[model samples]
Each structure stands twice: as structure tokens, then as C-alpha cells.
Target: MSASHTHGDCCDHQDRHQFSLRKALIPIAVSALLFVIGLLFNKALNNTPYSVGEYAVLIPAYLISGWSVLITAGRNILRGRIFDENFLMAIATLGAIAIHELPEAVAVMLFFQIGELFQDYSVGRSRRSIKALLEVRPDTANLKLGDQVREVDPKSINIGDLILIRPGEKVPLDGEILSGQSQVDTSALTGESVPRTVVTGETVLSGMINQSGVLTVRVTKPFAESSISRILELVENASSKKANTEKFITRFARYYTPVVVVLSLAVAILPPLLIAGATQAEWTYRALVLLVISCPCGLVISIPLGYFGGVGGAAKRGILVKGSVFLDALAQVKTVVFDKTGTLTQGNFRVTDVISENGFTQSQLLALAAQVESQSNHPVAQSIRQAHGKSVHKSGVQEYEEIAGHGIIARIEERTVLAGNDRLLHRESIPHDVCIVEGTVTHLAVDGEYTGRIVIEDELKEDAIAAIQALHLQGIQTVMLTGDNQAVADRIAHTLGLDQYRAELLPEGKVAALEEILDRASHTQGKVAFVGDGINDAPVIARADVGMAMGGLGSDAAIETADVVIMTDAPSKVAEAIAIAQRTLQIVWQNIILAMTVKAIFIGLGAVGVATLWEAVFADVGVALLAIFNAGRILR
Candidate 1:
């Protein structure tokens, strides 16, 4: 058994023998004792017993499994905190024993303990998954001392301390690589599936695994202040920030448990003492029946279990649902607003075609374009330089000047070159033909003559169309928002078959669009969700009812602000997130209805004379067991 699993009197479930074989032994021992005693009594005397001894054998089993609860309840009663679950279980079981219902009392406690065990097992499994993501603070790091490697705690490893990372080892601290290159798996931090390649001069984060090559890293951040550690802390404390449903259930149980206890006491005592004129034993038996019916086991436990299961389940699938409130919000999301660049399309720019004019070769036009744009750092400039297929030499370029948002002007071998849109050519009074091409076009001009134009565009994401269709199937309204011009936006939107499209929006414009949708959705039965992947989109992400981040290539600000994070860059995960949320909500409602229905039936039966103490005990524990099992179904 793992040492972490050992707690108080609870058997360590990690132990193979205790969890499996020992549990199997409990029923066998009970059966043996009961059967042997009954046979011996039958053989010795002439009286044929009704197998009553079989029920008596259950006492040892119940005490073995649930004695901790009984002790805890007794301790609470001695103090003043007597209205808890432990107290409820103890009272109900003791009442059943007083009514001469040994089997029922033992069965109820046994079944309840079994449910508790199951919860512990499920919780342990989830804890394992959570721990897998949590990069624990490393106690020691391999710091280079002279020519040899020495072991030192991560805290002791200061800035510029060279830490050697061997194969299959986690990076001890965040720093820039001093030497070597390797594929670092960052699935723990971003929940992404692929490994990221990192080389010298590039930054590497702590808790990432060095897959194959060895690396000598320098420690930049302190051990206590690492990003992975901070994120783990956030995840651990996430449960404390409960949803409205979680708070409601907790409050509901606190009042509901005490009320049921009082009502059960009244049902047991009032009628039998005044109206029936029954004997003390007969009245006490009825009171015990009342206690059994008023257990409240189902409602008290299942609601929180349902939500916990939902959150943990979503986490397993690489979706970081912050809390139950966000999960609930996502289930009812109708309008999904998407940012055009990184959210719906691959934001990377690629050169598509080069349309040359005035008898200029593609190479000559591209070289002139690259020389002028060498002084510029625009995305289009980068795409043009990358597609030129030759290294650019800035020695020939003289007097380079940037024209703000328009373009760039430079002198290459005394030839005036302008590499920008038609706006720059028009502003410079340079004559240019209207050479129309699809997507984004970067015009090139040399000596006031139109040389060529490079077509640079952002491609649509592979699953963009399918993702929108999936949302439509779920009756959700999909909307696209972009800062791109109307013509370009319309081309991408129409290709994706989106329900609605809005183009030419600034950062504030996008926020206004989200607010309008949210206002409209407030009157309806759904929430407004914004999906974006830029720093400027953080305000809109925070303002929306539910914010989804496209991870992998997503910005740190966007991922940090969003409620749900899709680990992959694929937009199709948006639909998957909604589907999972809807499923979780359905499971929660099902558990609530089932628990309430069973409680109502048993409570009504216990109030009258129709049900016995044994039947009431079965109703309480059986319903609780069923509801817990139902909650666990979500994990599967």
C-alpha cells in the first residue's frame, strides 16, 4: 500500500490484500459463524430455529467496517456538534438496535460504509490524475560544480546556476537553455499532447520532461515561485470557491438534516404516546422506525459528489473547467462568439502566390520586396522574406524608413523600393495596376514602378467547419468576430458556414459585441460564451458568461483568463466541451430527482404504520448507495 493512502482507521485501498481479499473475507466469516451456530443448536436441541442466528452474525462485520463512524458520532454528541452525517448514521443504527432489528441496523451501516469506501476509491483515482498534472516542488537539483555535477535543493540553486537535465528527467527550474536541444513534453502545464522542441537561447519551463537529448539549463526563477507550482496551488484551492449549486446543497443539507431528525422524533413519540396508548417498547420501536426513515443520506452526500465527479471528469479530458458554476454555465451556452485569427483560423501567415508585373522575374521582385521589408517587422514582411528562398543582405539597402502602418521605403543600389499595400503606392504617387488576388496582398514597387505583389494569408483551421456544425446540431448560435476587413472576413465566414458574422471590430468593438449578445441571452435561457486567443481579448473573455481558450499555441493571458481550455489548437474541442458539460448537468439532475423521490416515498411510509424499522433502514441506505453509484457514472 502507498503511504499516502493510510488515514485513521480506514483500510488503505492501495493494498491489494486489504482492499480485495480482506473485503471478500468479511461476508464469508459472517456466513460461517451464522450457519455453524444454527446447525449446532439444531443438532443439540430438538427445536428448529428460524435461522435467527444468521442475522446476529452481522454485528461483528458492521463494527469492523463502521466503528470509526460510531466513535466519531459519540464524540460529537459529547461535544456540541451532533447534527452531522456521523451523528445521523449513529442515531439511526442505535435506534434500529433498540427496536430488536439487529440485521437491519448492521446492514444499513455496512452498506453505507461500502458507499464511503467507493467514494474514497474514486477520490483516490482522481487524486492520482490531479497529482500527475501537479509538478511537485523538487527538493534537489543537479547543479554543475566545477567539472562535476552536485546535488543541491532547487531553492539553493540561484540565478545562472547551470543545472544538468539528463534524459527522462523533469526540468528542475525555469531558465534559458545554456546548451543542447531536446523535445520537452509540457503536457503537465498546458495539458497538451505533443512535445515542444527547445534549443539553446530558448526559454524552458520547470516540470517539463526532457524526452531524449541532455540539456544544461540555468535557473532563472526561484523554486517557490515557479509557474507550475502556482498553477497547482490554484487547482488545489479551486474547490474552496464553490458554485451556487454547491453552496445551496451544503446549506440545504445543514437545515434539511436537522429538520428530518426533529420530524422523525415527533413521528415516533407524539402519536403513539397520546393517541395509541401503546406500551413503552412498542412506542420506542415506532420511534426507531422514524429515525431510520429520517437518515437523509442520499440528499446530504450525492449533490456535491455529482459536481465533483463532473469537474474531475472534465479535467481528465484536458479541459480545465475552473468550477462547477462555469460548468453549469457552459451547459446552457447558446451564443458562441469567436475571434477570427487564432481562435477560428491558424494565425500563422504563409505566402501563397507572387504576381509580378512589368516583365520582372519572381526572384527579382521577391528580392526587392525582401530588401525594402527587411527594415520592417510586419507579419506580411516576414512571410515575404521567408518565401524568397534566399538569405537577405541588408548591406546594399541604404536609408531605410518605416511609414507607420502603411509600409516601408528603402534604397537598394540607388533604386527606390516601396513594399506595402496600394495605399503606400497611392500616397507615394507611384503608378500601380489593380492586380486582384484572393486573400491578403502585399504590393511591391521599385523606382515608382509596380514590380510585384506577394499574397500572404492566414489559413482556416482544419476543423473550423465541423466545429460550427456540431454547435448548430446542439441548437447553439455561432457568431464570428474579427478585426479583418469585411471582404476577407466574409470569405472566411462563408467558407465555415457560420450562423452570424461581424467584421472590422477593434478590441473594444469585440467587447461591445459580447455585451450585446449577453444582454440578449440574459432575457432568454442561455449564456454568452466568448472564444479568443489574444492579449486584447482578455477583457471580453473575462466579461463573457463562459470563456473558452484555445491552448497549444494560445497566449498565456488568454489561457489564464478563460474558464475552459482546449489543450489542442483545434476549434472542434469547443463543441466537445459543450457536450461534456451538458452530459454532466443531466447526470446531476438525475441524481437529485432520484434521491428526492426515494426520500419522499420512505418519509411518507415511516410517518404512518405501513413500514417497519428494517424497511426504513433499507430505504435510506439503499437510496444513498444508488445515488452515489449514479454520480460515479459520470467519471466513466
Candidate 2:
């Protein structure tokens, strides 16, 4: 009985999870059919007078294509909001019918729905793209209950539950593999194409697809707190935080629509009352034409849609822009500050040279260093351990103390092991040999005597130099802030041609350094963007005008807090995102210019009684269609 109940619950949940997108396209199909029939009726009545049959046919066509708009106008009227597009289109077409222009009224509503259909399509396309990007959500988990493996909803599983994942199945929840080995594809979250190899005791995140092996994983996090769930939450709330341009357009439409309504009213009443030659019928016709031009649907619809397209295009390239505000800020950035380790460089250290003093074997020095360094996970320390090539048990080490940004101090069986920078040796009053090296040097002192210096280096990313050059080409300055020594920082700065460098800084120091760069950029009213691999740089990323996180191997704090997440851990995406923002802005301004110029000309002619209803329709509906298509160019 319990098994059947759970199975039924799963089936019901699966039905709800699947959305019928075809249902949304039904209205579009109906509107298109009515549009075609309306056109046919208009062509048939061009040379003939319409009777009751024609009125009956045209009225239904208008209602079939525009019932939703009519209902929305009525509802908004009851709510005391009457100057929106629905009201404008409804009033204009109803007035045409009152003037006995039956065919024109149907045509107006048909064309209006055509424009509306495109608007719906644009909005739907954007929403669908975001949904598809988040398609990583797993529907069911293979729950392992003793010897039985049963299917269950992911939400029904809890922490510490054992789950089995087969080949090509998504990891249902964040967990650690209890057994088995396989390669898991994490491209859904990180945007990297390469599948990561995993074995027993390795933790795997939700939304990753397992390939080539069966595995048992112990759930570590619930479904609500998973990675894909958080991404969905971010996207769902993104639109509430509008861009500056979107807000301006919202306020503009609030006044622009009502004012134009009053203008149309004045054109209808005042001209007939003040001018002797003007008749009521002629001026009222002109008033109807003026009403059609009053709606700024072209500008209002296209601008936001253009920004959405830009964001969708960026998503396709593995960049997640949380909102248009960040996209707007990205366009105006004059300076970009970068975190050094794990950002500009690979963050993987390799020992270049091991200098030994006083006839001590190099192997003895490395073994001593690894014994102490194995206690820490610092990148340089790991490099030393890797170079040592032999594992040193940590049980023999005693009294370990870590000095921030400098080095470490430990005792290996009564032999004091100091493995760190020059500052660490100086602080301990240990006389150490000064070794001039191009790469980072970790000084090692044994029993307060200078032994040798080990040189470790983190090579620059393959695209770091090119990324800096591209930013320079765009007239943007670049700065690097790291906790490395001055020598290492200067070497990287010179090689990358950066404008400035701040070395040997703590996390707080990085934030302070960012403030200095931001203050300098204030003179130009420009923004500053800080890009990092996203773990230790969260504070600086939060303080910048735009926080761009390299998200291929991202941390949750950075991915959630940063406004922009570059999916691939490549610096080049930073420059590419800026280009997309600039291009979006360019298209927005073009739509503004195109819509305003055409509307001004048509409205001027409309006010003078020279423009016909046909001209008015084209000025309103045709311009909207053109601007929407123009906005589509952002994706290209």
C-alpha cells in the first residue's frame, strides 16, 4: 500500500512538472486566423457597401482576435487604470466602428493583435530560454533502501539517504559518492564542457550528469538548497529589479499615454468648435487617427525585450546576467580590478627550483618542508608537497602556527620548521639566506638557521594577457590585487601590461584597494568591475559596481552574490560581456530613434487632418513590428 501511494505521487508530480508550451501558442494561432479572414473581408468590401451580413461577420472577427484586450481594458477601467495600451487600442477601434468604418475597425484590431502576438512571442522566447537553461532539475531519485532500489521524487529524499545514479542520469541532489567511479558532466552549472572524473569519497553537486558508470551517493543537501534551485530563484526575481532605462520608460509611458489621449480629445472637439469650415465628422476622424499614434507600444515593448535578448545571448555563451541593471552598469565600466590567484593565474603552483645551503641534500630539505606544509592547504604549500613527491605523515609535527600573508611555523620532532616568506623568518629572528628569484620564493629555516629558499610559481592564464589587451583596446584600465610578494606581483603586472598593481594585501586590503580605484574612476562617472574566480574574492566582488565571478569552478557565495557569473573560467568572457552590453545599448537607442522619428512625422500629419486611418495604423502597428524585429538583432 505504501509503495503504490508513493508511485502515484510521483506520477502526479511528473504530470505537473511537464509544461504544455503548445497551449500558449493556441491564442497566436487563433489571432492569425482571424487576421487572415479580416483581410479577406476588407478586400471583398473595397468596392461595395456593407450590409447586416458584413457587420455580423466583421464584429465576430474583431471579437475573436481581440476579446482578451477588450476584457483587460474593461477590468483596468474598473480598477481606475484606463490609459494603457489595451484602453488605447480599444477606444481607437470602437470609435472607428461608431463612425461606421466597419472594415477599418476590424483591421485595426487585427493589426493590434498581430503586434501583441509578437510581444507575447518575444516574452515567451525569453522565459523559455531561461527555463531550458534550468532544465537540470532531476525528476526522480533512485533511492537505495537496504537491498531494494526504488524510484522516488527528489524532494522526498532527505539528508544522508543513499541514492543510486546510473549512467547518463543527473545527480539528483548534492552528495558524496559512497562507492563507484565515473565521469560526471557539470556543464549545466559551470558551463565547462569537460566531464569531471569522480570516485568514492568525492562530493558531487546536484544537476551534474553521471556518465559511464553506476554509483551510490549519500545525499548531503536537500532539494530546496541545491545549486539549480538557487539559480532558478535568482532568475525568477531578476525582473523586479529593473534597469534605469526600463524605469524611465515606465514613467514615460505613464505620462505619455494619458497626455496623448488628451491631445486626441482636443483635436476632436476644439477644432470643430473653433474652426468654421471644420465639421464634426472630419475632426472626429482626425481625432481617431491621433489616438492610434498616442500609444508608445513600440518603445515600451522593444526596449526591455532588447535587454532580455542581450541577456539570453550572453547565457548561450555561458554568462549569467542577473538583471538589466548589471548589464547597464557593465556598459559604463571604465576600470576593471582583478584578483590575482585563481583569477589571472591558474592558481596551481609548481616548484621551479629548490636551493639548499651548507651541503644539505636537496631531498632532505624538501622532505622537511613537506612534513610541515602537509598540514595546510595553501596553494604554495601544496606545490611544495607535490614537488617533494613523497608523502610526509603529519603525526610527527607539533606546535603549528600560521602567520597570515607570510608563512608558517611548526616543530618536526624538536627541529623548528619555518616555511613561509621573508617576513616569517624575520618575525622569528631567524637568519635566512636571501635568494633573488623571478617567481614566488618560500623561505625555509631549520633550527633558526638559514637553510635554503624554495621557488614556486603560478603561471598566468593563457588568455590573461589577451584579455588585458582587449580591455585596453576598449579604453578601459585594468588593475591587479593579490596577496603575493611585490616581486611576483610586479612580474605579472609587467607581463600583462596592467595599469597598476597592489601586492601583499589581505582580503580587507583588497576591498580597500578597490575603493581607491573606484574613487579615481568617479571623476569620469564610470563604473568599476571586479572579476575573480569567486571564492576568496567575495568581499571585493560585492563592493564593486559590477561583480563578475568566474563560475566554472565557482563557490555558492560568489555565484549568488555576484551580479554576473561568467560560466567559463576564461578572462576573455569579461570583455565579451561588455561588448554585448554595449551592443544592447546601441540597439535600444536605435529603436528609440526609429520609433520617435516615424511617430513624430505621422502624428504631425495626423493632427493636421491630412493623414488617413490607414497611415495611422502603419505609423502605430507597423512601427511597433519594425522596432521589435530591430530588438531581435541583439541576439545576432
Candidate 3:
């Protein structure tokens, strides 16, 4: 762990909120103290209606609590940007003061400041959750300079520079361990509590804490491009890309605020001027109440805060929904497509069966196949090498060649060894009996004679079946697409009870399949999500309505293209993210309905002079507080 990253309790998510709360308390306490003093002197004693001495104390109370808001309103009005909550509060409270309702005027600003403090607290909590990953990297690194070490800023360290990480220090940058053996805690970045053991030649990422043993690391990435930095950048900028609902609310407020102001103007002037019994004092008081009721504080604060809290909640659960737009889309998802390998099944391949031909022992055929396949990084090749249980001599191979999809051909010793799929043997004019297998297989030939075949099986993830069942229960249709052979894809798809499966799909084919699913969802009034974790899946991830990446063990490309990233290598997180999105939307709608319904009734009452200025404070600031409380549930 870096010096900054301690093995502290995971429940340390409250520090930021506490800090914001401290700053908010000063204003809240001051406003409430002065407002209460004004109330006692003006209302409780002598049944005093209005007095010059009262105005002296009450006006100062309003100014103390709301001077910033008044200044902002004045500045915005001068800048021709006047329709906002600040303007609404400023106008309504000042109008009340003009009518000699000193207590109500002071109360309005005081309560509004309290509401703002709550907003700051709630927003601060959400921000901490979203930006928690920013704490992964240490502020400085122990740089190695000419056999001596000195602490330096991580930003100042260049790529390929050498650094030392002692026990309890966070790895400052993405680097390879030059010399060390230690278990590094990666929970901060990957969200997995288990510590990963690392040794020489192993790559470690920035933000991981070294549990034990000192490591000399060769940095591979600069601080700016490190994992933690990229994730922070993605999260910080996510809010800028507003959801459709947010855009609609923005447009609604732009027209709605001005319209309400004009209506309040008509209510104040028209009825009193035209009607014989109507008095200017009563009508203008009603107009002031109307202004407070019309402020869109509830809708404006609750909607975006709802999404912000949702994102924060998701981060707490090890899921990263890049933006509110993706969260909204995930809630409406009806079709979920999955890339077979690394998504549904463990990408790790294991040799399950071996066959021999040409009077060769299974062991000999395995050894020859392993030697030829050693040069390839394909999962099948790795599995074959692992199964052989013996290392091949590098000098034993004369010539080696890797034919893209066909596999490998090499001159092992004096004999030519061919190890690959059925296509490789056929291309080499070698005849071999077709082998029946349920998983991926590599057919081998030696010196123009058919040697044998090895079958490699990819086990399904422990949670794959459960994840599929969960989606099914949610009424989401599931599909699987892969480049694997038809039989293997068919069996896995059937075993998992998926709705559909497409086999032998290339990278482009996955995109084509995703487009078709999206077209279908468009007609069905739903969204389509594609789950994947590879470079090949990146394009499909970017094309889908919502892309969920298996962030842990997933390729960088897939994570970058995905709209949502499941921090663990679990398929079940997809369902978890959807549940969060749905809950978040539910809270947002609840707030919208509650705010609108209450405001409408109050606005009607205020226009007819049936509601008092005190009631107007409840309509605006009180409703905002209630809606905010409703929105906070999304984070929990």
C-alpha cells in the first residue's frame, strides 16, 4: 500500500460528508439562532405585528443567512441569467419584507439555507463514493537514484524509472516487479478483498498496497495514464454527459420558471386592479407566496442528486456506471447479450482429454504438441503446455510459425511438428479422423503423420448459472455469441438455459448481432445490453445500448468502451447494477411526484390568498428538503 493507502476499515466513506457537514453547520446554526431571536421579540412578546426595531433585527438575520444567495441572484440578473432557485428565494423573501412580514421573510431565508446545507451534505457524500478510487495511488513515490532512495511526487516520476515499495506502501504507478515476493492488496482498484501474491517479473498496477516484502519496480505507465487516474477522469466527467431526463428537466425549468414568474406578476397586479373588493396588500402577499411555491427547488435538486447518489452507491458495490445516462438505459434493458468466453465461462482453459495416433504414447503426443504450442499465447496453447507437465528446450525447435486461426507449425528437433485445429492438418495435407469433443480441440500431426488431438475445456464461472437465472426472473432475454465451434457454444448455451446462442462469430459478427438485438429492442420498447471483457468485444461494447464490462481480468479496451464496469470478474454484478439503476429511477420518480403534487396544491392556495407566507416557506424549502431526503435513499 502507498503511504496514503492504509488498511483502514472499509466503512471509511463518511469522512468527506462529515467535512462538508461541518462547514454547513456554521451557517445553519447562525441563521437559526438569529431567526429564533427575531421570532421571540416580534411574535411571542406583545403580540407585535410589525415594528421598525423588529425590522432592524430581522433584516440582518435574513442578510446573514442569505446574502450569498442574494448576491448570486443579482449577479445572474445582471448577466441576463435570472430564472433560478436563487432568484426565486431572493424575490419572494424581499417581497415579504416589503409587506412588513419580517418574521416570515427572515424564516424563508433561514430555512432555505438549512435546506442548502442538507444538499451540500448529500452531494458531498455522493462525490466521495464516486471519487474514492482517486485515493488508491500514493501522493509520492520512493524513487531510486544512483543506489539511494528519495521520496518524489508520483507525477514527477517518468516511465521506466525505478521505484521501491516497502511493506505498507502503495504501488505509485503501473509497473513490473524487478525483484520482490509479496502479496499485494488490490481491493482498492479491483474491489476484491483477496490479496494477490506477486513475485519477480509480475506486473502490478498503481493503487495496490504491498502487504509484505520490499519490491523494486520498473514503472510501465506515467501517473497521468495509470488505472486510478483514468477511472477518476471518467467519473469526474461523467456528469457533464447528462441523461435524457436531466436535459428535459433543464429545458422545462428554463421555460417553467419564467412562466411561473409571469403568472405570479399577473396574480399580484390583475385581480387587485380589476376587482373592487380586492386589496393590493392581500393580493401582493398572495403573489409573494406564489413565488415561493413556484420555485423548482424540488425537481432541480432531487433529479440530478438522485443519479449522483446512485452512481455513488454503485461505486460502493464495486460497480462503475460511467454516467447517469447509462444508469437510465440499464434500468430499461430488456435484451442482454453476453460474450461466451471470459464473460459466462472462465477464460482459463484446461486440457481435459488427449488422443494418440501413429503408435505414439499419449505422453509423447502431448510433449510434441506442448513444445510446438509453447510459442503461442492462445489459451489452448497455454493449457496444452500446462498439461504436458514438462518444459520444452528452446534450442530444440529449428523454425517456428504461427498461422492466425489455423494454429502453430514448427520444426522440433529434425521432425516437423504441426499443432492446431482441424484446419491446420487439412492445410498440411495430413488426414486425421474427426474427433468428437464438447470443448475446444487442437489436432496435431508430426513428420506428415497424424499424431493425436487434445481437447481443452473452459469451465463455466461459478455464478454464471445464477446470473442467467436472475436475468430470466427479471424478464430479460439473454443471448450468447462466440467464435468457438457450434457444438461447444450450443452445449454451454443449453446448459445455462440461455434464450439464444450464435456460434462461430468473428469480431465484426458480434457487432452485427448486437445491432440486430438493438433493432428488436427498439420495437419492443426496451434497451439492449452487451456484456463482454476483451479487445474484440470493445467494438460491440461501444455499439450496444448499454455495455457492461467484467472489469477485473477484463482487457483495457473493453473497460474503456463499456458504459458500466463490474469491478469483479462476476457475471452476477450485471444484475446487481441493473437493480441499483431501477431503484435509483424509482426514487427519482417518487421525488418528482411528491415535489410536483405538493407544489401544485400550494401554488393554487397561494394564488387565492388562502396560504400564509410561512406556508410558502414550507412549499418551497420544506418540499425541497423532503425531496432531498427521498433522493438520499438511492445511495443507501
RMSD of each: 6.7, 6.8, 5.8
63-119: candidate 1 lDDT, tens digit per residue: 765586787667666776667666666787777666655556666666666655665
lDDT of 2 by residue, 1-636 (tens): 111121122123223444344653565466556556656775555445655555656777778766766886787688777677778778988999888776677767667766766655655565555766578889999999999999999999999999999999998888889999999997776666889899997888888899989999999888988767766676666666668887777777778888988988998999878988999988888989888876677877788778888787777676788988888999999999988887899988999888888667788888888888988868888889989998689999899998777788898898988888876887889875565678888888888888888888898999999999999999999999988888889999999999988987877889989998899899889999999878768888999999998853326767677998886668988999999999888888898899889988989999997888878877888888888888787776
lDDT of 2: 0.80
Candidate 3, residue 485: CA error in Å? 2.4
Better of 2 and 3 by lDDT: 3
By TM-score, the better pick of 1 and 3 is: 3
Tens digit of per-residue lDDT, candidate 3, span 1-636:
110111011112233345456766776687777778877776554254546567667777889887877886777688777777778778888988888787888888888777777776777777776556877758999999878999999999999999999999988888888998999998777667889899998888887899999999999888888777767777787777667877777777788888888998899999988999999888888988999888787788888888888888888788888889999999999989999888898889999989898899999889888888877767787788889989787678778998765778889888998888776787899987866579988888889999788888999999999999999989999999887878899899989999999986767778888888888889989999999875458888888889888854325785578888887788998888899999999998898889889989999898877998889887787888888888888877
Clashing pairs in 2: none
Q: Which candidate is the best by TM-score?
A: 3
- Model 2 scores worst on lDDT over the 10 consecutive residues at 1-10
Taking all chains together, each candidate's TM-score versus the true structure is 0.77, 0.86, 0.89
Query: Over 4 Å off in model 1, which ranges?
Result: 1-63, 74-80, 98-100, 135-163, 173-207, 216-227, 351-437, 440-455, 552-554
Model 3: lDDT to the true structure: 0.81
Report model 3's TM-score to 2 decimal places: 0.89
| Residue 298 error, candidate 1, Å | 2.4
Q: Pick the candidate with the highest lDDT.
A: 3
Q: What is the lDDT for 386 in model 2? A: 88
